[model samples]
Target: MQTALNNPAIIRFLKSKFKSAGFIDGLKIRYRSLICPFISLIKMVQPGDSVGDVGCGSGQFMLLVSEFATPSYVYGIEISERLVKNANELFSTLPRG
Candidate 1:
């Protein structure tokens, strides 16, 4: 499945999220978004699949999966409590479609 990351609107929204997050978090987000192969991962998913991401950091990968894939469910596991909270906050903002 082709990720809509190429969509200008999605790129702008992701950039806005990065900007709103502070510098360190923004850098981490950028690394996760660009350096990590979330798009490639998305390609591997089939509709109705359930995905679990270990060391999911701030859940950016899972968020992208939720946005771009037809996965039945997405789960993210992170060690840091703060990151978990942040991830939950991020998830809350996303619409359940």
Candidate 2:
């Protein structure tokens, strides 16, 4: 977060993520269809399979996949720089792709 102290976009995005109730609500709505199917699909995929997780905020799911049976490489795409930073903090060694 210190790295993002000077970035308005990251600061604003993080502020909104924390200040607004709509963030989590909207996340649930956005992931309504994708959440389960993705886990199932990732389970089916063998090791080394390249999977892209779109809008991978904070990447808990990606970390879960990595911890679970998904030996395949997981890629995380996050539009918000705040999420990118948080995700990196949580899983520093995990590559974005």
Q: Per-candidate TM vs. native? A: 0.75, 0.52
Instruction: Give lDDT tens digits, candidate 1, residues 1-97.
Output: 4456544434555676667777876666556455656667777989999999999877877877777778888889989999899889888877664
Minimum summed lDDT over a 10-residue window in model 2 is located at 1-10
lDDT of each: 0.74, 0.58
C-alpha RMSD between model 2 and the true structure: 11.8
Give me the overall lDDT of model 1. Answer: 0.74
**Candidate 1 runs further than 4 Å off:** 1-10, 29-32, 95-97
Give per-residue lDDT, candidate 1, residue 46.
91
Per-residue lDDT of candidate 2, residues 64-86 (tens digit): 55654445577689999999997
- Each candidate: how many clashes? 0, 0
Error of 1 at 2 (Å): 9.2
